[model samples]
Target: MDDAQPITTLSGQIVQMGHLDGSLIERMRHEALTAPAPWKAEYGEFQSGGWWTTSLMNASGDAADVRIADGSARPTTLLQHMPATAGLLACLGLNYMWVRLARLEANAFLWEHRDYDELEQAERHRLHIPLQTNTSAFLVTGGTKVHMDGGRIWRLTPTYAHGVCNLLGPDRIHLIADVYTDDAYARLTKHAQEPTVDERLPTASEADLSEHLATARRLADLGYTAAAEQLLLRLFYSFAMPEGTAYDLIAGLHTALGDAEASKRWTAAKSTLLALAS
Candidate 1:
């Protein structure tokens, strides 16, 4: 996996599914960028600023209920404004648990974490449709970087550790759907294709880790606490390391700053988010 080569089907990666009409794709894009969404910022620790989401379908019919809950989903008011999106979702016909539009602004990041860990144990999958995205935006999973290109639906199993980033983007937006395994979903993914791009990230050596830690420390000493934390968090995107290395580094940074509670908090977060053995 460390070798620089195109990845095949693997854990925690996106598999390209069937395509959508170009015209429909355009409409989805327009609605994504123009819709009056009730963007909510949840999962604060799982992101590095600028990540927002609005529920289109959820257990509660409120768009602000972006935190996922396992239940029968109902349409939100935001979905009412998006006729094209509603129509498209209706056409596919799957058992949805939740649906949301996630937006990552320029320089934003979603830190490494597993999802659906808190939901009821059942067969579930996440589907993504890239409505608006830039080349600078991509997902890192299984040590491979995948730029989920538009025009097709993509399926992902988020039980494995993964992260996302938009380095220098126009905002990146995608319609994310969480669905249960059913006949319709089986048909939709029966012919799922391979992703177009799968680039392996550069491995981080001991020296690289030391240098980044030192830089973070310098920033912290200069009173740029948030910047220091983000610097360590961003390491996940730049190099391939162990599943929770960045979180460990962040905890270490807090310890060095004489904040024992903060250090403990990050340490606990790593365990919870990665679902590590107690």
Candidate 2:
């Protein structure tokens, strides 16, 4: 019930509550990989290019509408074919808002950021079921890295600043559901436990940061602007810095390169991505 309503912007906790059947997980994975899903490239500002999502349940009842919104959600066309997933969802019996299959491709990232800020204020939480994932795919939050292994339901209070990466992945796909709090939610999360792979992220010293900044500047000078920006963004995974340091570094990179406009843009990106107060 700690998830009843979060008081802080960043929950900073990854709790493992309950689990799923292994055979059922494999079945769902099969459907997720083989089924013809209308994957949409959404939340462009929050992710690298390869991150994609398809709705299993949404207000519009369409698989292509991946954005979270308020409504009495229903299953999308894509969910119809996924009986195993659908069955699991039904059994959970929580008050639904939306559900989706998020696919993070190799070398992809969901940069350090908060969530649910764009939605109507409500008591809700996100549950993740990792169907297909690799060792290199993990989530970073509270200055720590957590790998939400399969065969379990993982709850992450995404209101906190966090980042996800599929560094060397084949593909990391997960079933993410957003549901309103209710009796069913209490039942599902009653036995919450700490994540198994919560490892504190390593810190980057000033020298390390300077070397990275130099590398980014070099990339930018070579006209690899996008790559340079990505390099800075990826710093979130490599080191433990304050919430928006990567964005700050990016702005500095542009400023050092004499691109005032790009610097200003990255400055704004920092505020937006971190949901920072103006």
- For all candidates in order, the CA lDDT equals 0.88, 0.87
- Residue-level lDDT of model 1, residues 1-278, one tens digit each, is 12242222355357999989989999988988888888988999788889999999998899989989899998999899899999999999999999999999999999999998888999999999999898999998877788988888999879878889999999999999999999999999999866766887887887998999999999999999889988988888888787788888889999889999999998899988888776
Candidate 2: give the clashing pairs.
10-160
How high is each candidate's TM-score? Answer: 0.93, 0.94
Candidate 2, superposed: residue stretches over 4 Å from native = 1-12
* Model 1 bad stretches (over 4 Å): 1-9
Give per-residue lDDT, candidate 1, residue 248.
85
Distance from true location, Cα of 132 in model 2, Å: 0.4
Which digits, one per residue and each the tens of the lDDT, describe model 2 over residues 211-249? 988998888888898998898889888777766888888
Task: Estimate the TM-score for candidate 1.
Answer: 0.93
Q: After superposition, how far is residue 135 of candidate 2 from its true place, in Å?
A: 0.7
Clashing pairs in model 1, backbone N/Cα/C closer than 3 A: none
